[model samples]
Target: MTTTPERTEPSTTAGERAMLEGWLEFHRETLERKCAGLTDEQLRTASVPPSDLSLLGLVRHMAEVERGWFRRTLAGEEAPPLYYDDADRDGDFHPAEEDTWEEARATWQAEITRARELAADRSLDDLAARTSRAGESYNLRWILTHMIEEYARHNGHADLLRECVDGSTGD
Candidate 1:
């Protein structure tokens, strides 16, 4: 059986950057823990009928989010959407029959790695390379906090999804 990933507790007395990164990492591991020990089919199962949210779908969506915020916005790369476009805005939340858990996990992890690399040398106050659709630029601090918030919110969804998947639940 697959095992849950271990999460590190965020330090209370750490500096701003460390605290933010710590919480983000903790939430990331929380998602992985929620999806752990599930087969490809289990990962793809949409336990909630009205909501087509699955563990695999969440992973894919987060991958897209990471790439969008870090690669495209922060680094100003030309990366396009991996699963969605104008016609399919919710594509990431709807994994195809052929989509596997392994592939989704790999893609998500790679995006996280790339995001860290992109933000490594930049200061928290460093402005992003690109502006939002409303023409507002964000700094690294805002991006990091936003990412943490994003993961925290999604992790809550993941908690319910995991319990529905196999009767597994935890913080």
Candidate 2:
């Protein structure tokens, strides 16, 4: 298990970087606020009757997704994916006994840290210049906006999932 990174408050910025940074900060706060004061078991608890959504799962999945977009896609790194393989595209949330609460939180921290580092070096206008999973190219601007969309969407899910987990809600 990795160590959780230090807490980061929102920072000031300007221009397109500001926009992306603001979105990232918003989602980061939303996720943390949702995860506040929850136990490992509570984090892993499913919401609703049939849904397998859990805060832990969401955290892990977002970590993987963030790494994929920011680190791998933008930085041109070659790595096996953080999650999802042949038999388990959704294996992130369904962690085995080997995964602890600390591990889950750490995973998220690491990815978020990497993302911040990447964002610090690149502008939203920087070209992504890579093919996506569907064999289409994208610009950095598009990825930045897409990330905001992705986080906003999942954070919405996190809101309800958190509510189901502990009756907590808000920005």
* Best TM-score among the predictions, by candidate number: 1
| Over 4 Å off, model 2 | 1-14
Encode model 1's per-residue lDDT on 36-116: one tens digit a residue.
888888899999888999989999999999999999999999998988889889999989889998899999999999999
Write candidate 2's Cα lDDT for 78-160 as tens digits.
74666577799888867665666688778778888887887677666676645778987766778778887888898898889
Q: Whole-model Cα lDDT per candidate?
A: 0.92, 0.76
Report per-prediction Cα RMSD to one decimal: 0.9, 3.9
Q: After best superposition, candidate 2 residue 125: deviation in angstroms?
A: 2.3
Against the hidden reference, what TM-scores do the models get?
0.97, 0.84
Q: Model 1, residue 104: what's the lDDT?
A: 91
Candidate 2 TM-score, C-alpha based: 0.84
